[model samples]
Target: MPEADSSTTPAIVLDGVSKAFGANVVLDEVSLTVRQRSIMVMLGPSGTGKSVLLRCLVGLLRPDKGRVMVFGEDVASLDAGVAKDRRQLFRIRRRFGMLFQDGALFDDMTVGENVAFPMRMHTSMSAAEIRASVDDKLRRVGLPKATSKFPSELSGGMRKRVAFARAIALEPDIVLCDEPSSGLDPVMAATLDELILELHKTLGMTFVVITHDTAEARTIADTIGLLSRGKLVTYGPTDEVLRSNHPALRQFFARSTEGPIQVL
Candidate 1:
């Protein structure tokens, strides 16, 4: 509900971000900045810590080293209660939304209730107001009539759309999508991508998408980061990364086997 500056103050800043689970390091001294209102795609093979980085960015996971700043506040050091209070980071987080890979909808609740879940938990809206908001969100996602169905009743794509509706219910400034196109076919994937771009242009919101689909990445990302072995191997504009001669990036774009990525 807050107005994001959409300036160059970095929507998210990870300085020397690292994480280790005992002896295995998931992210190693990775540093990156996501500019406001830009679509940043984090691409890498499986197990390269893409999801880990995303969780850290959203404060779901804390890194062992360096700092994670959201809207200029250090989230890694903020206490649990303080982090959720009326602080800059909390307000900034309210400006962002997230869509998980599985849609993550509650099986017991109807689609409308699912979309209204956040509003119910966070707001003091009356029952009628919540219903109105839920209806609006469903219509926004092109699923005005799918409100009564449960998650299992809808198709995978429909469930995803419901999840998306829930994510933007609060009109977040940014949307973090983890493998948004993972379970959809080409047609459905493209439709979802179109929805993303449409929302970005219409709402003036930033997007941080994590996906390994090159086609989708090329289609949606203004900036791309190629991550490998817990590090950002390459980062730049989509065209620049595609035109680059770096072996890792080149082989990745070409779908080659002999590159920095190990096929284990």
Candidate 2:
């Protein structure tokens, strides 16, 4: 057990953000703020722009309207000219790590290579230093031995753990995860949730998780945001959001087909 930090400024903020692709509108006036070192769950059905919102938070996707501030800096305000300097890009990218769905590991790279790739690209560390960092992060994710294994050879859960290890290798202040529990069994998903909670306690990192797993969110989130049709339908503490009786909230909780959500 270690000393835990109970206070920090908001890590990420969005105000009146909206995005569209051709005829399809993704995010609609989405406004939210994630506190530092807290796990905020973004709950929404598929195609509801959860991933789009996560991308915008990291400055990966520029919104058509509104602002995205990371660590109090308006990331959306940084001009494209900022990336002209490799050092600037490296510094900016170091503040956050993103773990995408399906692990997103390169099939051709070994797990160790995948984990150390960022270090190699961004830092001037020697081989020994990179190895040590990769090993330590993999150990944190409970996958120290799987480093020699290729992504194709590892189980889905193991791949995810490796991905998590890689994401945190930089000691990023903020972590964004998209559908972390996807393709896992109930028990495995719960285990991953516990791992995430453990990391939150140990690392003191801000986490924004975009997941449709209500059960998982209930277990790990300090607050939850529910998205529907590109709009934030509900946002509050975990218990409050989950227990609410709003029609849309009820439909989400029931996971019903007759609710406000419709699939094409």
Candidate 3:
């Protein structure tokens, strides 16, 4: 992978971004940039706001201060009125597709219906066109023949793959994945990782993945941002961030209890 040109606008930028829920500050003065066509993995312990940050990037959560720029538009600056904000967010969200943890499929829908859901909702494509696209995407994710299966019938990994197919059905420029490897055995996790890599390379889309798995991050991240206690402990190229001496990050990646990161 080549370094992104500094002169080019980044795919996503978060500057001095902060978020809170009631009195709890989930993110404080966090800043990071995701390069175009690159994979950025955000690593952190649970409840450290990794998912919150992802939500902010996609305009699901508005920050208290600072700005979030996606594809050069400031999402945080949208109008405060509910209708206007929603309109703006809808436009911004068109550029992104999200894969939630646990797949989040509709239990009543078949795999084919789930994969075709986005296109059905977002596009006016004919039924034939949507079916063709769903088949293509399912095949891409290695689930060609499983479309008739319901969510309940598939394994955890298969459900995840179906969710992934749904996410990319619209061909969004960016894909946000929350814990893509969670709840899987090592072999299944590895399979999912390879699929992520393959899709990234073949589709050339930017990916922002929130994960607690350091090894998965190391495998998929071109850049790594480690969050702790509502703050970004480190952010840089994967190798550079991994080489840092930051206490919180050191404890995180090394899985050690002898550092500043104490589990509650």
Off by more than 4 A, model 1: 1-6, 81-92, 126-129
How many residue pairs clash in model 2?
A: 0
Estimate the TM-score for candidate 3: 0.92
Steric clash count of candidate 3: 0
- TM-score for all predictions? 0.90, 0.90, 0.92
Provide the lDDT at 261 for model 1: 79
Q: Quick one: how many clashes does candidate 1 have?
A: 1
lDDT of 3 by residue, 1-264 (tens): 233234367989899999999999999999888888899998888888888888888877789999999878888887647797878778889889999876899999999999999899989999999999999999988788998999999988889888989889998889999998887778878877887898789988889998888889989999998888898988999999887767887888788988877687
lDDT of 3: 0.87
- CA lDDT, every model vs. true structure: 0.84, 0.82, 0.87
Q: Which candidate would rank higher by TM-score, 2 or 3?
A: 3
Best of the candidates, TM-score: 3
Model 3 stretches astray by more than 4 angstroms: 1-7, 79-82
What digit string (tens of lDDT, one per residue) describes model 2 on residues 1-264?
Answer: 211222444788788999999889999998988888899998888888988887777667778999887766676665555655444434556888889876799889999999999889778999999999998988877777988899999888888878888888787888888988887788878877887888789888888898888788888999898899999998888788767866776777788888787776
On residues 1-264, what C-alpha lDDT tens digit does candidate 1 reach at each position?
333343656887889999988988999998888887789998888888888888787777879998987766677765546645436556556767889877899999999989999888767989999899899878877788998999999988889889999998887877999898888889888987888888888887789999978899999999999888898888888889888867877777788998777897
